[model samples]
Target: MKNGIEIMNVEQTFNGKKVLNGINVKIEKGEIFGLLGPSGAGKTTLIKILTGQLKQTEGKAEILGKDARKLTGEDYKKIGIMMDNFGLYERLSCFDNLKLFAKIYEITDDEISGILKEVGLLEAKKALAMNLSKGMRNRLQLARVLMLKPNILFLDEPTSGLDPATVDAIHGLIENERQKGTTIFLTTHNMAEAEKLCDNVALLNEGKIVEYGNPKELCRKYNHQKKIKLHLYDGQNIELEHDKSVAKILNRYFEQGLVETIHSTEPDLELVFMELTGRKLDK
Candidate 1:
């Protein structure tokens, strides 16, 4: 039992149009792996194949050491999914909605309350799902999945269209899940979120993986300029190559107390993605 996900040359097509092409990756147990790409980039298609919702046109996908195509009801019990179409009973109160899943999962009301509180929804427990704000609805959906305590979690665009505070709250919940040793497979087009949450990420574009690696390492690998960006006390900005030849000039600025701030010219995840695919992550 590998206790993680493995995909070997996985490919999917619809009407002879390839949506995923020769995709290959391995996700270790308790790892947070991100599939990042723009719309129509096959991220959702790959997730569906991994979760057994859809069969691949070729190759293999194994989840929790079992073939994805042969996942059983018990296998599904060990998986938690939160996606846009994960419906909520609009007529039901938040507490009731959780209660429904709790019953299915054989959990107690106490557990439901605890998770609700953890997601900052305890005060809105009795509020109808239809009346809750988008953030609250998102939290409730998260609580629903977290309460399952599944070994694997699939989150598709979990923070899309969310406010900063709400996104932060969701990120906190996700971090807590990571601490619990849950293997998370996240699909998102948000580069910043992927950089913050993913231990390793695959940059998908036009049905192929353009790049894959630790987000920070990928950024550093693409940092070609090797320069230092500096701000001076007189509001002057300078970009200088990070070489011994510039050491004297840098020391002079510091000696004169003229340096305000300095930063390395390492590219961020978005920049790295762009440099690799010649396209923006959001586009």
Candidate 2:
């Protein structure tokens, strides 16, 4: 579990106001690490510092074993970024826009075609950027990021404001990249999305990490009730608390072979977060 990204007591300030407060995190190589928080939780600011787009006022950030503040142009080539507003030439056709980025990266036409096909945008390659649907536009942005075959990807709310199907499509693409061994740094308030894509997650609140771990582990950690609902094959159900008495009853039921389904009353990520942070999701 080598460290791919590390933030060591990182702090940031803007206009004399503190934005991040002693944040510490470590993401292993080839892991989909999620920074989950509501808007204004300093997730984006931290990401910018990690990407070398902004320098932190205090502390350090390390990416791929290189100090983020000292990252060179070649290091930038190994990482791709898709922020809330990934650039695209609205007046240009999809192909032309890709051509411009390809030229910047010194990629060939054949490579561009391959990227287009990978993102399912080959048929609409010649379509004007303004003419493509929102989903198509997202795919086009993804295609541009793929030109460098980036080893690490930073995605900020990649599926925000899209329809369900489009979100699923984008998630599928992201999963494909992860399968190919790309380390992903994801910032989003979508808990469900984090649970689906992340191998580990950090709960950011008011510029601090209140919790961090694998999603299921965090959820289980805060499951204080310790109750389970058993649905019997005969259509009867029983609720049992966690204690020696209930354990004996559960074992008896199992011995009688009446159990069909067992539902544990485990708190979900949201509940765990709310319990920890004393807050809920944004709106």
Off by over 4 Å in 1: none
Cα RMSD of predicted structure 1: 1.2
- Scored by lDDT, the top model is 1
* Residue pairs whose backbone atoms clash in candidate 1: none
Model 2 lDDT per residue over 205-265, tens place: 9888999999989888988999989999999988899777987888899999999998888
- Which numbered prediction scores highest in TM-score against the true structure? 1
**CA error at residue 125 for candidate 1, angstroms:** 0.5
Candidate 2 lDDT: 0.88
Candidate 2: count of backbone clashes, pairs at least 3 residues apart or interchain: 0
